[model samples]
Target: MKARTALLVLIVALLGYLAFFNFSTLAQDVPMSLGFTEVHGPLGLVMLALYALMAAIFLAYVIAMQATWLLEVRAHNKALQAQRELAEKAEISRFTELRGALDDKQTQWEKRVMERLDALENHLKARAEESDNVHAAYLGQLEEQLRNQPGKESPPALGQQ
Candidate 1:
């Protein structure tokens, strides 16, 4: 399935074919020297045995590497998940705090606007009262002047005219 696996299979098939064809040569005895002793053995079989051992060792190493990598990736994923949760909580907290601040500002603005309106209403009422008093005084002076001058039929009173 994988390139390395395919190549390994190819190599193994070629060796099997070679060994099958050369059975006589592989069976012939040859002297082999171990570091501790010397012995006569089938050289081809000995070489095949060594190759098998090396393949087993390589397979074991590959399995170990794959397992270690998987565990490291799992740990990294867990850490990322935790970080994501923390970030979401912080974002929610900021949104809530901002909402509270905006509400407070809106309330303050409403209070200030109401206070301004009340002050303006009071000022307009005072001005209207002052204008009424001034008009009344002018009418009283006109009436007094008419009385002192004796009868020129006095002009009609203010509203009556």
Candidate 2:
């Protein structure tokens, strides 16, 4: 279906056709020398088998490398996730600390305001008491003067004409 797959299939077909056409030559026995003995086998078929074995080995190597790469990528992603979690935790801790400081500052400000209000109330109370004392002394002096006047029998009532 895909272009690369089609190309591979075409190449295999061509090779197969060539092999089939040369079947008799491929089947012809040839002498092969081992270290201690001589053997006979089809040379073309042996060569084809060796090529297939090498191709299989190469494919295995590629699969092993791909597996290794996948493992490394997974490890890297895990490390990155861990770092992100640590950063988030640190940020939350910083936020909590800042919030606590702000709350403490607010409490102190409220306490100061309350103290100032109490001081003002006490000052006002003291001034009112002093005014009351001065008024009472002035009234006492007026009463004594009225009693000492020789012609006055008694002081007139406040509402009398």
Candidate 3:
């Protein structure tokens, strides 16, 4: 695998650097450093090769991790979207049911209102008829009284009354 190869290369370079640099001797500025005796040249090439391999390995790992995390997020988001859609549908259905019930109630209320109005209209018509009959009877009584009054100045002529 590329990852394994890169890891191996990195290890080799790191070891080479340790042998050549001899950090302990360098830090103390010791004469004839251990690194010079141990590494025996070629230090730069060894270190470079190892560092390149390590970089490759780390890059691959990071890319794989990023891809995996991306996929998981996408799947989770999809699931949430599905759930949201279902909830929306349920809410819509509930609203529709409520709307239907309200419509039915409104229709019933309108019917009752119309029926009451009709009853009131009929009652008013009857009352009007009764009033007309009472008025006619009163007129007849007045006419008879006038006729019986004989020659009392002819009971004041028309508009004179």
Highest lDDT model number: 1
Clashing pairs in 2: none
Q: What is the lDDT of residue 160 in candidate 3?
A: 54
> What residue runs in model 2 are displaced by over 4 Å at the alpha carbon?
1-25, 32-38, 124-161
Q: Model-by-model lDDT, in order?
A: 0.91, 0.88, 0.78
Please give the clash total of every predicted structure, in order. 0, 0, 0
RMSD of candidate 1 to true structure, Å: 3.8
The digit string of per-residue lDDT tens for model 1 on 99-124 reads 99999999999999999999998998
Predicted candidate 2 versus true structure: per-residue lDDT over 13-121, tens digit per residue: 8878988999899889999888799999998898878877887897799899999999999999999999999999999999999999999999999999999999998
TM-score of 3: 0.58
Q: Per-candidate TM vs. native?
A: 0.69, 0.62, 0.58
Model 3 stretches astray by more than 4 angstroms: 1-47, 150-161
TM-score order of candidates, best first?
1, 2, 3
If candidate 2 were superposed on the true structure by all CA atoms, what would the RMSD be?
5.2
Tens-place lDDT per residue, model 3, 21-133, is: 87554344323336546434444454557776987898899899999999999999999999999999999999999999999999999999999999999999999998898
Comparing 1 with 3 on lDDT, the higher-scoring candidate is: 1
* Superposed Cα deviation of residue 26, candidate 2 (Å): 3.5
In model 1, pairs of residues that clash are: none
